[model samples]
Target: MAPRPRFSSVPHHALAALRQRPAVATAVFATGLLAATAVVNRQLARKAERENPPMGRFIHVHGVRLHYVERGEGRPLVLLHGNGTMIQDLQSSNLIDLAAERFRVIAFDRPGFGHSARPRGRIWGPNEQADLFKEALDKMDIDRTVVLGHSWAASIAAAMALRHRASVEALVLASGYYFPTYRPDLAAPSIPAIPVLGDVISNTISPILARLMWPGLMRKLFGPKPVPEKFAAFPVEMALRPSQLHASAEEAAMMVPMAVAASKTYSEITVPTVILAGEDDRLIDVEQSVRLHRVIRNSRLRRIAGAGHMIQQTEAAILMAAIDEAASISAGGGSDPRDVMTTNG
Candidate 1:
């Protein structure tokens, strides 16, 4: 009678109902997690935007808004940065300023990489990006310019040269990844970038994970040579913002396929081409540039000694020299007779 007094209010049927509906508890937990993650993501995004506002102008091309910065005036020299970066990467190295001194420098944030927007349902391959930028250039009345691309962007520059041969007068590819090379680590982000679940993951855990891993990744990217203090000072959190993280992951996921397809057309690029690689390039083997140089009939390959993959940052002088040379060749100055330089260690 004493025990019944305390338990009389609780019904056996109510306890049975709670035990039968565990899924409801799970759903509530999941929804709460997603809601919390969304809130945090928004706060982080706002902070990033406030700290790193757009440093360039925006133009609409092919139904997508693209961000770009233009400086100086002369022959138009277009700069395209690689994965996980924006126009700042080139600007940080002063490549834009240096090239602007002699050429009209136009540095673009490839679709989704910076302030640019990637339209839904777009695959955004190198060819697609090349065509989109070409259209943008057309709208600006800019044509037949030297296009410089670093890392993954090298493929885009090559695609531009091949697909819009008349518009791209020359190409300077730095730390480029050519040929189909399988990289297992690329799959980590790739999986999370797929459709519905990817959207959730990218907005939730991906940005946080990316921020944590970025420091280590930077070290690897500049191995055998230290990352310059200036480059390290870049607003990295901007790149880790949810939208950019998703975009970069998507691009990285598609890289292998893009390279496989683009490799077939390397020999077809007829524009004056300059391939620059660091002798100690840890991200991409210098041999890729060598092979690329071999295939592109009008290419010259230069290997910078003691430089890592980020030649644009660590070896601006060398990169500027290559850009200048490419600009010269594009203006009918002709290629340096030497097809390849001995590796400098």
Candidate 2:
């Protein structure tokens, strides 16, 4: 008989077994891909950190280190950024510098968003974040300051106003997401931020997918208006790092439930409130700001025309004016007549 052909030094039995159990082959391939992805992700993360170092100082609050940047020297003004951002979001837009010229501007990276730490096994909703920030401000001897929160931070500002009323003199809520609205898109990250496997996915494939999706999502966020020129230079890669991505997912997941609970307590905020919304805000409805203005008895609402969700960057002049009005009202001075302009889109 002719010599039998040997299969590339492999046993026919093993080859047949692999073919019989296709799932085993798939699992092996998936494991290799995951390992490779993890190695590449680690290298990229290290490179990003080396390129973009921390831009602020750190202070320990309840044994958790918080990062913040302060400027100017006048009435205290605390700036809290939205989800997926750091203090640089305010700094790059020159909001901190502009406010700093007249007020002691303190901009913070809310726990887990930047260099700040979010301890494991902790659920940090708006209330939890408010309490943590309150402790940090207390350590810094900061009290009775105007708190400005953009987007998701808006809810945190409201929580601070409600829980720590004595410390929050005024609130400037820009592009605030109030009144729990069903947003299926926003709910995407909620599942992946759970425990165990969720943690694994967030640290692995989540950041990778986020990095890939950022460009399109950012375009939508600044739609009907161009993204600020300075934003091009923002360290987005660093924000997309694994830890930050996980924190962002957690925050996004918690937003709706937190807003639902906090919306009921809007009337409790007695501080002078300034609700700002861009007429073209595509992220959160501008009507939310209108509702907020109605609920907070002392609120002044400003609807900016031709502006997008990022009013702090797009309509800085108007936003700054609103901040000034809020500060004045908090100081027992009446609201600015210019601030009560009619809503126009």
Candidate 3:
């Protein structure tokens, strides 16, 4: 008191108050951390966009903006990439270029992936996406074409064929989940799809966590075979943006339920179907393809050796061949001897 420690006495009182109100202190610290994380995420998202600009054109349809890459000239082939990827995924696989040589390839970002806009207030299940894509294709004057869906998009492809039978001539389903299966891994990612909580997590923590986990995930996806160098060109940061992360989370949340709903209608698919599966797919069982092939009477199953979930990257040639097979089979070829093409792993 005699020393007149004015500043020291004030700080001691403030520290005592903060210690007394630990809950408030925790809330304050959390708020600051979240604010900082949000700022960093925004900067990173902007940088990603600047580094990886859109490689295709945009089309506004049904109150949504869709991004797509068009190439070559021949029978129309519409590519629907799986969850967490965009047109670049197909392009990176070289399937787009290979198919472009023989078919008019149109690869889309599908609702929320890449540069596409995904409007909220609606559940974008397989049927919903199928409806949107159907309207979009119609707007572009694509009355009928071969539709290829990889992984989760496989359900969308099936929905398109089921809903618009006349429009979807054939289907190429790769690494697809046709039936409901136990997927505990989806739990963590699905958290970002929750309403208020999802918004906060996607904007703050998901992107950061994804950066750390990307490599291991890629390895698992392309396991049993080394990941191709070309896949490194994929803009991982772009996919890590908050909006895309939310979209991916939503898709993960919808995967099982969508499969449950879609499986009931698979046997009704009369279009020429080609089921492509990686024999050594670590993520999904190849038996999924086998079951799908059995269900779809007009389907052909091609199991690749030494391949994984990313058959597009590991077996692009085989994918191209499958596309050709879909096109050929769709052209009214009566019977085929090789309904099931299996190569030993």
Candidate 4:
């Protein structure tokens, strides 16, 4: 073997040229992104890390066991995440802490996210998941409370409002997709749908898939601008675990159909609702969130400038103010555009 001589550093112009070839640069960047989160997220668990403001704790309820962390127990508020992310989506998000101060913020892994058990032989959809959540609330002795959902959970929150309206108080939907359709090619787990095949593959190459997929998306999300080193790693590391992919796949399977079905049902909602979205969110289109705001009467729309789909993390302060405004209206106070950015003060 021959040892090659190394240069001191590549020139700045050379680096710029490499970046110009986006596909090459992005793929390399993605390779690094996936690996970093697993490292930092491991450290996050140390010191018995408290969940944002109210601290995280779990409970057992409904047919399936649930894992949730509750903080500041006054009004029961549930945080549901989008697909491809877990309760960590909220924990790793700015929304968790913002709500913990005023409302009893409860965030959990929906059925298949985080450490929750995936029910056998059940079709996991927004409606079914919402029903299970209502039972969890009942088991926790929470009769009526606001439901906050993001992306996929937005549909679930709507289901709760429409089906179990008596049990729901108000609604907050952020970066939502109202279920009328979904991207099918990507949602299904690469190797899980078969009978004998799922069993064989689950035992075999699943770990590898989790490892590679986690980092790649992180890189893409942060492409134009780099995401903070620490934040990017935690969510992916938490997502690529065992039951995580299985649950993500299941919900994704039912996602498109349920979304299509739910879109038709959106006009049925009569709850006091608040919709917040990033004017620049690249994941779910901003128009979808806007459409939702227009359709649901007694609903308010908030648009944050330059923020992406993960507004809770990217524009934490702004997102909090929007929530505060939502709370004010729900509490019977006069809400105006003036209240929109008031939290900045």
Cα-based lDDT at residue 193, candidate 2: 81
lDDT of 2 by residue, 1-345 (tens): 999886674677777887899999788779888778777877887788789788879999887889999899999999999998888888888898889889999899888877788887788889989999999899889877899999999999999999998899899999999998888987677656877777777667987888788888887788788887988767887787777888888888888888889889999888889999988888888899988888888888888877779888777777788788899887875544323554443
Among these predicted structures, which one has the highest TM-score? 3
Arranged by lDDT with the best first, the candidates are 3, 1, 2, 4
Worst 10 residues of 4 by lDDT: 336-345
Q: Candidates' TM-scores?
A: 0.91, 0.92, 0.94, 0.74
lDDT value, residue 13 of candidate 4: 69
Evaluate all candidate structures by whole-model CA lDDT and list the values in order.
0.86, 0.84, 0.90, 0.68
Per-residue lDDT of candidate 4, residues 1-345 (tens digit): 899998757677667877899888888776566456444434442222333222345566656877787777577788887776766666666578778888887787777666566777877788888988888888788888888887778888999999998887778888887746457554446445455555444433454566776666654443323465447435454465545655666665665677778888787787677788776666667788778876787677777666667766666666666566566666674443322221111
Q: Clashing residue pairs, candidate 4?
A: 34-215, 37-233, 57-69, 179-259, 180-259, 180-260
RMSD of each: 3.9, 3.6, 2.7, 12.1
Task: State which candidate has the highest lDDT.
Answer: 3
Note the clash tally of each candidate.
0, 0, 0, 6
- Compared with the true structure, model 4 gives a TM-score of 0.74
Q: Comparing 2 and 3 by lDDT, which wins?
A: 3
lDDT of 3 by residue, 217-297 (tens): 999999988888999878888899999999999999998898888889999998988899999999889999999998998
